[model samples]
Target: MSKSIKLLAMFGFVAAVAACTSGQTEEEYVVVNPEPISVEPTYTGKYK
Candidate 1:
């Protein structure tokens, strides 16, 4: 392979690797549970 072509390929590989690994972090999660809730309906004069 030509020198310049090989160099470009290596640079591309390094750049791709760096981008893939730059933001490595721990995973995040959310836990939810069911709960009872009470609500009142609004009244209008038309209902009466």
Candidate 2:
């Protein structure tokens, strides 16, 4: 009877802790906007 009571107490404590805790983690999302790329001007001539 004494061992059974101790085991019951241990199981209750575990159950209480498990009930209070969130098992899964919350995921955070990050959004990134890419910058626009500009094209360089074409070379007209080597020298003026």
Candidate 3:
């Protein structure tokens, strides 16, 4: 019974350490906006 108690304690310690170290990753993000384009008239001469 004593050996089984020691084994359970060791397993619990390992699980706690694994959980603490597995969630430490952080990500960064960036956003960008482009300018709009302008269009001019095609014909400017008078028609008969």
Candidate 4:
């Protein structure tokens, strides 16, 4: 093959690989539970 044709093919292959890898990135989300739990009192206070 000619030098120019070989160079063009190499450039095309590099561009294709770059495009494919560019779409493989992923983003993640982190969740945090911020609500407080409610509970009944263990004992009742007697009136003085």
Best by TM-score: 4
TM-score of 2: 0.46
* lDDT per model vs. reference: 0.87, 0.88, 0.87, 0.89
Name the better of 2 and 3 by TM-score.
3
Ranking of predictions according to lDDT: 4, 2, 1, 3
Candidate 1 residue 35 C-alpha distance from true site, Å = 22
Candidate 4 overall Cα lDDT vs. reference? 0.89
> In candidate 2, what are the lDDT values of residues 1-48, reduced to their tens digit?
999999999999999988777555668899999887987889889985
Say which prediction, candidate 1 or candidate 3, comes out ahead on TM-score: 3
Cα error, residue 24 of model 3, in Å, equals: 1.2
- List the candidate numbers ranked by TM-score, top first: 4, 3, 1, 2
TM-score of 4: 0.54
Higher-lDDT candidate of 1 and 2: 2
Worst 10 residues of 4 by lDDT: 39-48
Top model number, lDDT: 4
List residue ranges in candidate 4 displaced over 4 A: 30-48
Clash pairs for candidate 4: none
Residue 2 shift from truth in candidate 2, angstroms: 0.4
